[model samples]
Every structure is written in C-alpha cells, then in structure tokens.
Target: MTLQTNDSAPHPNQFALLKQRRFAPFFWTQFSGAANDNLFKFSFTVMVTYQLSVSWLPPALAGLVIGALFILPFLLFSATSGQLTDKFPKTRMIRAVKNLEIAIMLVAAYGFFTTNLTVQIPVLLACVFLMGLHSTLFGPVKFAYLPQVLSDAELTGGNGMVEMGTFVAILLGNIVGGLLVTIPEVGHTAVAIGCVALALIGRWLAQAIPELAATDPQLKINWNPFTETWRNLQLAHGNLVVFRSLLGISWMWFFGAVFLSQFPSFAKEVLHGDEQVATLLLVLFSIGIGTGSLLCEVLSRRHVEIGLVPLGAIGMSVFAVDLYFASRGLPVVPVMGLGAFVAQSAHWRVMADLALLSLFAGLYSVPMYALIQLRSQPTHRARIIAANNILNALFMIGSSVIAGALLSSGFSIPQIFLFTGLANAVVAFYIFLLVPEYLLRFVAWLLSHCVYRFKVTGEQHIPISGPAILACNHVSFVDAVLLMAASPRPIVFLMDHRIFQVPVLGWLFRLAKAIPIAPRAEDPAAYDAAFAAAAKVLQDGDLLGIFPEGGITKDGTLQEFKGGIMKILERAPVPVIPMALTNLWGSYFSRIEQGGAMVRPFRRGMLNRVGLNVGTVVSAAEVQPALLRNRVEELLA
Candidate 1:
C-alpha cells in the first residue's frame, strides 16, 4: 500500500535506500500522522454513538460535531498556515508539527484513561481541532515541497503516491478505531496507548524527510485571520484559471462531505441495516478512494490530466443511479452483523456503489489540485491553496445544509443520491462550458501525446492550460503549428500580417483564428486590432502564442524579442508561458538574410527531430518587457 518505497523502482538498492535518511523517515511520519488522526476520530465517534450514556442528543449530532471539529481550522487558521509554510523550511516545520501532535496525543490519552465523559468530551474535541490545525499548516508545505524535490516528470507520480498513502492510512485508522471502540473490554486505556504509540511512530518518521528551503523564506507571517483570509482569496481570484480550478476542487469536497455525512442515515433508512453495516459502508468508501487515488498516476499518464474530471463525473452519476435501483428490492429489516450483511447478495451492490463513487471522487479532485499547484504564482502559491481550502470548507458546509433540508422534506436517501448525482452533472457541464480550458487541455494533450513524436523538458515551467502568452524561438512558418500541436489548449497566435493573406496557410490560420499584428509604424490600425484580439483571447482564458522576434531567424541564431509582447500583456494581464523551438533553427523557410523569400516551399529533412520546451507561467506583476524577453531567451539557451 505504501508507494514511497516504490518511487525509485525494483532494484537491489531500492529497499536499502527506502530505509535510508532520504525517504523512510518522512514517509513513516506522514503515514503515522494520517493513521493516528483517523484512529482518534473514529474511536471517539464510536464511543459517543454506542458507549456514552448521554441522553440529551442523538448519535448523529456527535457525528456532526466530529466533522465540524475537523473542518474548523480550515476556516480560521489556513490563511496563517499558508504564510507559515512559505516562511519556514518544510521538513523542520513538519518535525515541529509532529512534536505538537505528540503533545496533543498525550492529553488525548489522559482523557481516554479517565473514561470521564465531561473530561473526555472536551479533550477529544480539542485533539480533533488541533489535528485540523496541524493539517492546515501541513497542506501548503506538502504541496510546495513536491515541486522542489520532484522532477517535472515525477510530480504526477509523486502526488499520486502521496494521495494513495494518505487515504490508505485513513482507511486503516478508521477500521482500527471502530474495532477498538466496539470491543468489549479494550477500554479507554487501550485507546490512549494506541494514540501515543502512533504519535511516537510519526515523530520517528518526521526525522527522515530531507530538508528543503521555504518557497519564500522572507514572507511575513500574517496572524490576523479575517483580513489575511480575504487577501488570500483575492490572490487566488487574480488568476481565473487557478480560481476555476479551486472551485472544481471545492465542489469535489462538497460532493464528498454530503455523501459521507449521509451514509449512516442511508444505511439505516434505505438499506435497513444496523450500526455495523454503516461502519462497513464507510470502510468501503475509504478503500475505494484509496484505490482511485493510486489509479490517478496510471490514468493521467503521469501528468495533471483534466480529461479524468468528466470521466469521474460520469462514473459518479452512473453508479449513484444504479445504487438507487439496487436498493429498491432490499428487505426493510436490519442486518445482524458484517457476516450476514456480506452473505446476502444485495449488500455487494451497496459496496460497489460506494467504491465507484469514491473512485470517481479521486479522479475529480487530484487534477484540480495539481493544476492549482502548476499554474499558481510561486510567491503566492501557498496562499492560493489556503484560499482553496477555505472555499472547500464553505462548500462542504453548504452541502451539509442542503442535504439536511432535502432529508427534512421527506426525500428518501435513494432519492437524494439521485438528485445529487443529477445536480453534479449540471454543475460539471456549466463549469466546463464556461471555461473550456479543461476540455481544451485534454485536446492539446491528446494531440501532442498521440499525434506527435517528440521529447521535451522544462515543460513544467510552461503554463499547461490558461490565458498564456507563448513566446517561442521562431523558425519555420509551421513553428506555430508545431507549438500548437505540443500545447494542450487552443492557441491564438500573433503572426505576420502578410501570412494572413497566404493561400492554404492563410485560410488555416483564419479558421483557427490566429491573430495578425502589423508593426506599429507600418499599419497602426492593424496593430491596434491585433492587440485587442490578443487581450480578448487571454481574458477568455485562451493561450496567445506569439513569435516575439517578429520574423523567422535569418542567421540560425537568436533575434531580439519585439516589444509587441509588452503591448499585448498590457491589455491581457495574463501569465506568459515561454517556449523554445530548439532544433527547428535549421529548418527550411528559416530565412537566413534580410528581405529574403518570405514564402519557401517544403524542403526535405527539414522537420527531423523537431522539439519544443515549455517553461512555467511568469506573472505580469513581475515581468517587464525586457525581463520577459530575457527569460524567453534563457529558456531557449
């Protein structure tokens, strides 16, 4: 289940290296942390529901409180955590956080040992909230660290491994906690011992994570939650692509929260099952999510693949609807235990339904998080991610409220599932339609990966999907086409005004809607029109591909990037995704002299070994025209 050891491959030294300082410790630390969190939460929840003698409220309210305690830190502390992640070394901070968990767990153990409801209740809630706080601080550091330690090619796989580990740990912890609470004589002391042991394991693991400097070590800590939270949200909103990705991710959380929260009620009301069956339902969901999270690495071809989102959505809807019908003929009687529930054929349908839902949930969420990491400005990446967590919390809270209303209105659990599935379909359609970038990225990915034969590096620096200004080293006229083919989104190229009048290429450019710009002194009107078009494309979240050298290189060497890019960015305000066309320098039609033939027919062997290198998005705020031009030059070099 642990993907950490498998990262390198199956070699003699791999196992030895896995236990070495570079990998084992951090891996175990994160694993132990996840395990301990679920263990405490699951045990506390089970105790409240089945063991407590309190008569004031139902068990469902306790479940809600558990959910609330876990989510509260995201609302209040995530912004501060974001700043802290940027300001401190990740491994050091992680070690410190693990120590804090040890302290928290000891207090938790004290409560468990006492078996005092009033004392245990407050202590338990405090532990849950503290764990939430720990997660809040850990979130940004975890994301930011990957890009530093992982190569661009390894990022997707690394992320997949992390997600897989986290969820599996969750499942084990939940199962253990449930079993511990349900056991006849294990008592609170056993629970305390388990938590303390897990905490110690986590501390040992934290010692293994390699040290990496903070993304912005000088970043000031902003302690005020309210103003800083608003600021973080605004920073995320500044990039439309990132903002939309955040929304998609938040929607996924909302979907999950609603479904998970409704499980107990659904098991009891629809499946006519008892508490044990409800526990099994939760276990099935956790396992499914863990499976799906690992599968993302294979499904995405080790990249932030947006194509999986629609696929996940479709699967969710299909399985959800099937679940409704599957429960239709089931007996309206409580199942005695895990054995009887499984021995019956109907329960398998419920298990399948939960698994497929979790699988789809993983597919929908992973890419969005990766996209945000890939596209967000480095200086503010942590803050933007914090903003994402905030939105996720809000959406989940909203989902809970909506589900309660639906249940109160006499809708059966099956009916609510049907409704949620349908609503998800609508929302998915609307978001994709509004911002076609996700769809277009999939298109670009298919074209580059399936249609072309090429190798590339520095591609991570390139903005994969967004309103980007791609300034590549121009060579042949088809330079635009090759770049477009490499790109995963439709690009609006700013090309020579004369090319707009060519026969076949002209019509093709027109059809693809390439933008044509004239030199400002030559045709001011044309120049103005080109700028306007470029701005509109970027604002619409489309890529703007441009040749900043104004024309093909005549000497098989670099030419100065024209200032036209500056004009375009002034209007667009989108990030610039720099690209380099390296081997195309010697291609035919790459005019070698001034005023040479602008139109050259195809030459033999001109397209051999054509390659493109993409770099990351450069924010408009940091890019002056000269600096951007230089940055593009360096990418080519």
Candidate 2:
C-alpha cells in the first residue's frame, strides 16, 4: 500500500506508528519469529546437554557447537538471501521465510517425538542450522523493510523499538525454552507443540504485512553463493561512514556476546548463585536494554542522535569498571535467590552496574542500526545488512575464542569483564576518531539541549539533500550550533574569525568544519579563504549556513543583513533559505544592560525557551540582503 505523504503535517512518533496497520503486523511477525528462534535454540540445547548427552559430544562442546552451527548459515547464505530480498518485494520474501520456518518446525516436532537420542540430537542441531538459515534470509528484510514502511523522522524510534523487542524476545525465549523442555514425561511433546504453534502464529501475522516494492526488480540473481557473498561485502564497504558504522555495530555484538556468554559463569563463581541468578541477570539486562531503547526516542526528540552512541560507550565502560569494583574482594557468600540477592546492598550495586551496562549498550547500538538503514544506497541496502550480519557473526565467534583463551590462561570472570570494558574504550575512541561527524553532531546536540529548549518550525524548508544556503538571524553566541542541531543534514557554518581564536571553541569550530570569516580590511587572506571554502561546500552539493546579520544581535532585535550572503549565493547559485532565532536575546549568550553601565553577556538562565523558525526558500534570482532580512524578521515576529 502506498501511504499518503503529508509533508506539511508533523510526523507521528514511534508509538503512533505501532498502532498503524502497516507497521504493527510486520513488527509482531518479526518479534514472534525472533522469540521462536531463541525458544527452540535454547530448549534444544538443554535437551542435548542434560537428557541426550553422548560420548562423542561433551556438554562443554554442546554450546560451542550450537553457536557455530547457528552462525554458519548466516556466513554461507546471507549473500544469496540478500540478493533474493532485493529482487523481490521484501514483504513477500518475509512471508516466504516464515513459511519456511513452519516446515522446519514440523521437522523439529518429528525429531522431538522420536525417542532415539542420537537421531534427536542431530535433528536439533539441524534445526539450529535451519533457524540460522531462516534468520539469514530474514536479516536484510528485517532492516531494509523498516525504511520502506517508515519515514526518515520515524527511523530511529522504529529501530529502537525493533531492537528492544528483540532483546525482550530473547529473554523470554531462553527462560520459557529452558522450562518447557524440563517437564520430564511431557518435555518433548511440550517443546514440539510450542515450536509448531509459534511458527503458525508468526506466519499468520506475516500475512497481514503490506507488500513493499522491490528496490531492483530487474537485477539478475547470482547463482553462486561464494562469489555473490564477496560482491555483497564489497557493496557494504563502499562508503567510509557506512563502513565505520558497520564496524561499530559489529563490535557491539562482540561486546554483548562476551558479557552474555559470561553470565552463567559470573553468577556461579562470583555471586555463588545457581541457575536462578543467571536468569535474574538475564532479565535485568533485558529490562535495562528495553528502557534505554525506549529512552532514545525521548532523548533524541525523534531524531537519530548519534551523540547518544558516544554517551552510551562512555557509560558502558564506566559501569563495567564499576561492576568490577562492586564485585571485587568477594568473600564466601551463600547461594542466594533473587529476594536474598537484593537483600544485600553490595549485590544491589552489582545489579545497578549490570543494568547500566545493558542500558548503554542499547544506546550505543540502536542508532547505528538506523544510520545503516538511512545511509546505505537504496539498491544495495539489503546487501549491506548482509555484510553487517557477516561481520557480526565473525566478531561474535572471535569473542568466544578470545574469552575461551583468556579463561583457559587462568583469568577470572572479573578480570575478563575489566578487559572487555577497557577494550571498548579503545575501540570507541578509534571509531569516533575515524568519523568525527558523529562526535561533532553529538556535541551540537548536547549543547542545544543543555542550554536551550528549541522549538523548531519550517525545518522542512531546508532541503533534505543537495546544496543550499541557510541564512539565519544571529541572536546569540551559540546560534550556529543550535541551527546545526536543528538540521538533519550537516550544515557548514560561516562564522566570525574571532570566534576561532577563543580558547577551546576554536578547535571545536575547526573540527566542525566551520569557515572562519574575517573583515577584508583586517585580514584579506582569511576573508578570501572563508568565501572560497563556502563556495567549495556548495559546489559539492552540501548545505552551508550563514548568519546574514554578520554578528550577534546586541539589543534583542534583528540586525541589518550583510552583503556577504549575496556574494556567497552569486558564487554557489543554490537556494537561499531564511531562518529566524527568537526569544534568546536576553539569555546568557546575549549582551545584558546593567543598572548603570552596559555589561557583557553573562550566564542568566537554565533551560531557556528559544525557537528556530525557518522561512521559505527564496530563489537566487530574487535573493537580496534586504529581502532575506524581511523574511527573517517576519519569521521572528
């Protein structure tokens, strides 16, 4: 179904989208499918380890074998599956994958019904591989389908809810799966019935999903998986920003796998708790992730705020380190149940650390998922997701190996946790260094929220893509940063050169790619360079923001427009958008009138209300300093 586009209307938030038909069915279908996969995987693993142990397969090898078997299909068939999704309507492909799940679940039911241990265990492993295959085929659709159904404004929250649902599903699946298969006489029957039921439910839900058009309908399908896989990986690595996001996301999976895989051991060795503690930790982490995921929408005000990613990384490291401290120097403690565990304050602190870890993990990861979807080329998006899946599998597998090596070398679980925490700091710094835009955008977002609450209107006037000149009223010292925060696309600001000489802000301005303009009389070279840089930015089809007033408003009134905007527009020939910033003149950054004498700008308020009103775009032929000023003043009014 082609939904009607109402550009003039404010976009509905993530929750509102959940109530709509287009998103609801698909969300439930995907959520159920994930839940079922984990349920079956966990149940089968339990049966293999306890009920059907064999001479050839040790209990320790069971988990490793299962892990490898599950990820193997993603490695082998993800490339092929990605092409299939791109060639067909994603909704239809998803339905087909759900149908495949039903058939596989029937086979699993038969395996469970059969009493032969040898046959049953192999069937279970085969089921794991098939589920992996099921997930691989669905991977690209899982991501690519969202952008089809959601608007850009909804992307971040949509991704957050999807990821949040997934973590919750995994939690329930593990808990329920473990319990279902331990029912003694009815264990096999229960597991069989549950799998078939979940498969049926997921397929029924998939039926209601609206059809989405294939991105590349005429593209030829590659017959060979190996060659196609290589090509798909290449497509994913094409852009530097996209590729670095890929690495960041893959590393998150590695970090998660490391911590999650250690839970059983951490609980047993450190807390002296049994099976219940493991489950408790799992539940706590899931809730934390869900909370953080939901909070992302609120924190970003429905934007994909990448600054949260860095904040999350910092929190993850700090909390992980705190967990080490909270749990260090442990004495012999009784195996406490959930209630007893909470009774001790020390254990509560540990739980707090673990919860914080999970919360930050959600913050760190959910944005990248949305970013990957929004950033990748449309035709190759599914392939890029495939590439991400490949990298995730590799990283997870690598983490397992590293953890095994560390533990085998006589390292405690605390030591491993500390190492992982420290490792995350190094990895985060490296990735942020590679993509400074994520960090810079983060800084702008932080500053905007901390000092002023922005009410932005006519933001749609700023083009989503291509070149444009944004001329705004300069009301305060932080006008550039506020405007940058309001824009979806990064805006290169042309600022007074003196601001570049101020202590730490100068470096930040340079890092933000701001053009430092000087008066022709004072420094002709800097003045010329500023105009040259502004021209280059527009020539390359990038947005450039300039405060046409030339300097900040002195007495809370709009200043006269300068001729520099006209010169910049003459060189670039892009649309000139006029914006107004109002209700900020008396704030900290604006000059103040003292009782007797004029005083400099001083800090005066917290969470002050300010508005950034973007006026309509003016054509270059009619672009004038007076005309732009009039438009800005009208908006400010």
Candidate 3:
C-alpha cells in the first residue's frame, strides 16, 4: 500500500514529508527521546569529571560504569521489546514509553535536589538504566513504524529527516547538557528541571501520533530472554541481505561508540580544550551527519539506495585518518574555550576532518535503515529491527572495551582514530565482498548522477512490491545501467545474446543476472531459455525488464513493440510498466553515426543531459504492444 505522499511538482523535495501528520509526530517523539538521552548522559559525565577526580573514583572508571548501566538494558530488553511491539499496537507502546519517561525524569529530579553526591550518582545511574529501557522498548517501534506511515518512495526521505532530527538533538543536548550540570552558577537543578520538562513534552507530542495496527497481533509472547533473543537473532539471520545490512549497521554503531566515548578526553588531551570545545566538536559531527542525511534523499532520488553505504564508508575512513594527522604534534598550549580553539589553523583542520567523517556516517546509516525497512518482511519487521538494536548494543559495548584496551596499551587518541578509520575500510570491504549489491549500486548510481546529468520522473508509478514487468523503449547500450540506477528494485534485464557475450559488459551483465535472448531463427535455445527465465522471475515475485522495442532505436524514435512482452504476460500475468529513455541517441551507445553505426563512445558527450521517465503500470490484459508503443512515445515526447 502506497501511503499518500504530500510531495508534488511544487514541493519537489524530501522535506515535504515533514509537513504531513503521519510522520511529524513520530519524528518529534524519537527526536525528543534522543535529545533527553544525550543530555542526561553528557550532563552527568561532565559533572563527574569535574566533581569526582579521586583515584578510586576516576572519571574514566565512572564513564565505564555509566556506559554499562545504560547499554545493559538494551542487551537485556531489546528482544522482549520487539515481541511486545509485534503483539501490541505501536502507538499504544509508544505512548506508554513516553509516560514512563516522565516518571523516570521526575525521580531523577528528586535525586538531583538531594545535594548528596553518593545518593545523586546512584539515582542518576538508575535513571540512565530506565532511560535506556525506554529507548530499547521504542527502538523497534521507531524504525518499523515508517513503512506503514510513508510510501516506498518516501522511505529514504523519512529516514533522512529522522536522522537529521536525532543528531541535531544530540548536538543540542551535548551543548546544553554539559553546561547545565557543570556550570558553577547553575548547578544540577537546571538539568533536572530541563530533563523532566523535556520528557513531559515528549509524552504530550506522542499523543499526536496516528493509530497503527500491530503487525503480528496474535504472536505468542516469549518470557525467556535468552531463548527469545536467540530466536530473534535467527529471525534476522533468515535473510542474507538483511543479515549483512544488520552487521553493517552494527559496525557503524561500534565505530560511533569509539568516537563518542572518547569525545571529552579527546577534546582535553588532544585539542587541549574545555567543555565548550567538546561541545563544539559535537556540533561539527552533528551538523555533518545532518547534512549527509539530508543529501541521501536527493542523491538516491528517494530510494533505499545502499550505494551510499560504500561511499560513506570510504569518506569515514579517509577523514578519520586525516583527523589523526590533523591532531598530531600540536604545540603545547593551555586549555582554551571554543573561540580560542578555532583560532588555530591546525585545530580548524582537525574540526574539518571530524565533520567530514560524521557527514559520511550519515550517508552510511540512513540507507541501511531504509533498506531494513524495505527488505524485512512486514509481519516480522519489528522483531528484525529489535535484532538490529541488540546487535548494535553489543557492538557498541565491544567498542568501549576495544578503545579502552588500545588506550591502556599506550596508544594516543590520534593513533586510535587512525587505526579505527583503517578498521572501517577493512570491515566495509569485507561486507561488500559478501554482498556486492551495495558496491554495484554505488557504481551505477554514481555513473547515472555524476557522469551524466540523468533525471527521472514517474518513479512512483512503479509498483512498490511483488512481481512486475518493466517494458521500456531501448535507446542505447548504457540504457540498462541507467534504468537499474533509477529503479526501486533490482531488475533482470533481458539482453541480446551477442551483447551478453561481450567481454567486459558481459561479465557485468552475468553478475547482474541479466537474461540473454536471441531471435528464435538465430538461436532457438537461447530464445527459449530467456523466456523461461523471464517467466520464473515474474512467478517468483521479482522485477523483470524487457526492451519491448527489441533493439536500440537507430533514429532516436520509438521502435515498434515486440510480441515478447505479450508472451511473458501470458505466462505470468503481472503489472507492466512502460518506460522511455531520452537524450541518449547522440551518445556513443546510440546509432547516431551514418548507416546506424555508432561513433565516439564513453563520455564523448561528457556530462550529457539524459532523461529516463517511467509511466504508470498497466494490467496484463491491457499490455498490447501497439498500446505500449504509444505510451512510451508519449512519455518520451
């Protein structure tokens, strides 16, 4: 079901989703929760550093204890929460969590007002655990709720907005939280009051969330955490793509944990700055992620394009390494405020590297989220998201351990950043090796947008799920790549047998599982095999692409449609979408030369303006070749 998108020709943007009621309430609900989390964490951590400096109660050990207290609940409760969300309506679950947050914050206010460090610390720690529990319970609901709230085409935009909202909130929390608790004039009371107030506001906004039905209403509740967790993991492992995406997402968390865990110390030891400087660094990273997240929608044309994952991974590592270099060998200087810190050129370079690293992190994560939402089975989507959260928690916990180990072994923060950046590259390569789809999509998407000014419209006309036939006007050799880049789903392109035998393109085509076809008179076996494969593709509920014009147009005009589409429809009746490619005839792939032979190839028309327009799907019975030709011609015109 395509949830109505409020975006239209006048809006023409990803942010349009924000104006709609279906997404805005939930967006703020999650945003406030994240802000509260970071504010509380940062405030307490900063306060402890200044107030609790004894050898037995070192700031480092205090941080470790706090981290454990907060993350433990995710490890303990994520699996259970997934089941709960699946069984109960998500809005109800969401409202309940928000109400719980208010109570947790009130207790926190009481502890702060006691004016006793011993009593306040433990109470605050318990508040951290309860907050973690709140986030853990809502994790699945936050992600799994999107597919129901927005259309497939809007998934990337929705995820992007949420990511932007979350990190910006974190940035706000970091700046506000640190100063609130650490400022001598204000003290902890200000923080306590703010947190409770924020929680109340979150609860009030959650009430605006539209009602949503449970995905698995009759799902049996499993009481055992160990057994339930194992089952949930298996459920996530059910799909290879889903599992790999989960690992990628978890690795990102691990990477983020390392940086976040080191933020305060890194600011002090490496940059020689105070709380304000630490807040500045958070600002840089937060703004970077928000920028990258917003760009993902425009870059992928609002599709769950995993190509950005590799692009993000590359930028993350490169910038991380650069950050180490930027931080190294600075002259001894007294700790300074944000203004003095930015005055130094070396420090500015350090900030640039940090900003670039996190910007790519945004690009890296938004798609992984949208992909999980798009790929996971709707009935078990929340459980799958729960599994992701559990893994994410484990990875983060492990990151703290590894970073601590490295730091204990005498590695400086710069060394750790360099090594961590290199580690990101290795892990990303390993994941890409396992699933090349991410990389291939990256290359194709890059080719379409960067190499050419390719534009697309009517992508929403394609069916969001199940089997469908994409019948298009074949214009050039590069048509397949551009189409694949534009499409929402992986398409099995029916290729001419001879082109399938071409050296470089053939190998790539084989990897994409493009079908090889020949005229029945020339090669009956190849012709028969192609049709059989096309039928099986549709039957198994996958997209199949057919050049109903049979071959590339020699005169840049729509060619006569072939009978293959009709035959395929007869075999496996499904929706047939008409697509047309324009502005490619003069390029090397087209037959623009004399005698219908090609001339200069490969970027000869460098940065050419190309257009790929998709049209609404037609019923199988209405997919007559003559009518299909008319539809293609009209779109091209």
- What RMSD does each model have against the real structure? 9.2, 2.9, 2.9
Model 1: per-residue lDDT, tens digit, 222-315?
8999999999998998988789888988888887777788887777777777777887887788777767766766666555676667667777
Superior candidate under lDDT, 1 versus 2 = 2
True lDDT of residue 369, candidate 1: 70
Question: Best TM-score goes to which candidate?
Answer: 2
TM-score (all chains, Cα) for each model: 0.73, 0.95, 0.92
**Clash totals for all models, in order?**
7, 0, 0
Decreasing TM-score order of the candidates: 2, 3, 1
lDDT of 3 by residue, 398-452 (tens): 9988998999999999999999999999999999878777877887788787778
**Clash pairs, model 1 backbone:** 25-205, 444-488, 461-615, 461-616, 462-615, 462-616, 554-592
Worst lDDT 10-window in candidate 2: 594-603
Residue pairs in collision within model 3: none
* TM-score, model 1 to reference: 0.73
Answer with 1 or 3, whichever has the higher lDDT. Answer: 3
